[model samples]
Every structure is written in structure tokens, then in C-alpha cells.
Target: MKHFHMLLAVLTLIIFVCQALPIWMGKTAKRSAMITGASHLIYTLLMLTGLWLFWQLYQVAGVQHWAIAKLVLLVVAVSATIKALRNQAVQPSQAKAGMMIAAVGYVGILYLAMAKPLLG
Candidate 1:
């Protein structure tokens, strides 16, 4: 069950990256970007649900560092999505940089979750 949840989370992350890259690269139109943003939102919700289910089933003690990092990355992703949706104009280079940073943050969270390395 934990593995299943992890898989779902990975899938969600992949979808998010796919949806974000086109916008960040200035390849997607405003309308299409909005649509993709909505899709990402839905995928994120699903991923969270999977994580919740895994926790309930496994009764695993939460990893504080992993959870906090994941939440921070999620917040960045949400903020980027909102900003992208609000502005129809092509994203400026700065916004693209932010998007790339958020992507890296997301990957970091995933790696921390999987690796569970000592934080010291």
C-alpha cells in the first residue's frame, strides 16, 4: 500500500512536470495552460488522497522533515499555478525560473521521501 501510494505520487509529479514544462517553455497557449493547470490541480488532490490512505492503512509514523519539505514544495507549485492562470500573457523569464525551482523542489521532496536519509 505504501508502494502504491508512492507510485501514485510519482505519477502525479510526472503529470505536474509535463503540464508545467510546456507553460514554462512558452510552448502552450494561455487557454491550454489554464486547462493543464486544472489537470495538475486534480492530480495533486489525487496524490494527497493516496498519501492519506497509505498513512491510515500502514499506521506509519510521519517523517517530519519529509512532510514539511513536501508541503513547502506543494505550496510553491500551487502559487505558480495560480500565477500562471491569472496572467494570460506568456510567462516572463523570471516566472519560468520560479517554475523550474518549484520543479526541483518537488523532486527534492520525492527523493527525501524515498531515501529517508539521516538529516544530520
Candidate 2:
């Protein structure tokens, strides 16, 4: 289950990068990533699998601050990604800011998962 969760996370990362490529590399083909059924599917699976994995972990080790923090970060990251992809009418700079926020959120999620600090 953990492996599956990690796989989905990696796929989400790749899809996000692809979607953001239009801003980063100035290629229009990558813009197709913004509104694809595939992107939606990937996000759905990533979220569901992550929740499933968290449930299983919670059963074993009980809840921790890192787990809660990671879940919150996941919400923010996905929200940022969705906003970034959906804002076609906004200025390109604003859209780019959304993408950066998403990326940072994802990094925070990953870091929390790995560090798993048991905050008091």
C-alpha cells in the first residue's frame, strides 16, 4: 500500500511538472496537461491512495502530527494545482505563482512524511 501510495505521488509530481511546463519552457503542447481527463484521474487516484495508506498507518501507529500536517499540505497542494490549471484567464505570472505554491506544498508533504516528527 505504501508503494502504491508512493507511485501515485510520483505520478502526481510528473503530471504537475508537465502541466507547469507551458509556463516554465514556453511550450504549448504541455498546456494540454491543464485540462485533461488523465490529469483528473491521476489526482483522484493519488488522493484516494494516500488516504488509504494513511488509514492503514494510523491503525498501526496511531495518529501523529506529521501525518496530520502532511494531510493538510496535501489539500493545499492539490488546491494550488487545481487553481493553477484552471486559471487560464489570469495573467501568466499569477498562474505561475499558483504552480509554485503547489510545488512548495508538495515538497512540504514529502518532507513531513519522511521526517515524521513526533511533535508535542
Candidate 3:
């Protein structure tokens, strides 16, 4: 489950990059039907697997602070990606900023998941 979750995370990041790069380059990002479909599927799987893993962790350790932080990071990442991808009216600069925010969110989530640091 962990490996699968990791794979989904990577796929989600790749999709975000693919969708964001063209907009960042000042080009209209016209996503193909396949990429769009795959992205939706990947996002759904990622959320389900993530929740399951969180539940498993909670059962073992009783709601770690880092886990809650990770959930917040996940929201940040996904919300930014959606804001950048869905709105055609968004300026290129804004889109770039959104993607950067999402990248940071993803990095933070990954770090928290891997390190499992003790937090207050």
C-alpha cells in the first residue's frame, strides 16, 4: 500500500507539471482527453490510499501531529493544482505562482510522510 501510494503521488506530481509547464511558458495548456482522464483517476486513488494509510497509522500510534500536518499539506497541494489547471482566465504569472506553491506543498508532505518527525 505504501509503495502504491508513493507511485500515485509521483504520478500526481507529473500530471501537475505537465499541466502547469505550458501555462508557465505562456502557452495555453490544452490537456488531451487521456491525460485528463488519467489525472482524475490518479487523484481519486491517491486520496483513497492516503486516507487508508492515515487510518492505519492512527490505529498504531493514535493520531500523530505530523499526520495532521500532512493532511493540511495535501489540501494545499491539490487546491493549488486545481486552481492553476481549471481556470483559463488565470494569468501566466499567477499560474506559475500556484504551481510553485503546489510544489512546496508536495515537498512538505513527502518530508513529513518519510521522516515522521516528532512534533508538538
lDDT per residue for candidate 2 within 1-120, as digits (tens), equals 778878878888887787787764543334454457777887788778878877888899887778778878878888877776667345566678878898899899888878888874
How would you encode candidate 1's per-residue C-alpha lDDT over 74-103 as one tens digit per residue? 677667655654552554665566667667
Highest-TM-score candidate: 3
For residues 5-68, what per-residue lDDT tens digits would candidate 3 score against the true structure?
9999999888888887787787878979999899889989998998899899889989789988
lDDT for every model?
Answer: 0.63, 0.76, 0.86
TM-score of each: 0.63, 0.83, 0.88
Question: Which portions of model 2 miss their true places by more than 4 Å?
Answer: 26-35
- Ranking the candidates on lDDT from highest down gives 3, 2, 1
- As for TM-score, the candidate ahead, 1 or 3, is 3
Q: Where does model 3 exceed 4 Å of error? A: 88-90
Which residue pairs clash within candidate 3?
Answer: none
Score residue 15 of candidate 2 by CA lDDT. Answer: 79
Off by over 4 Å in 1: 30-44, 50-63, 88-91
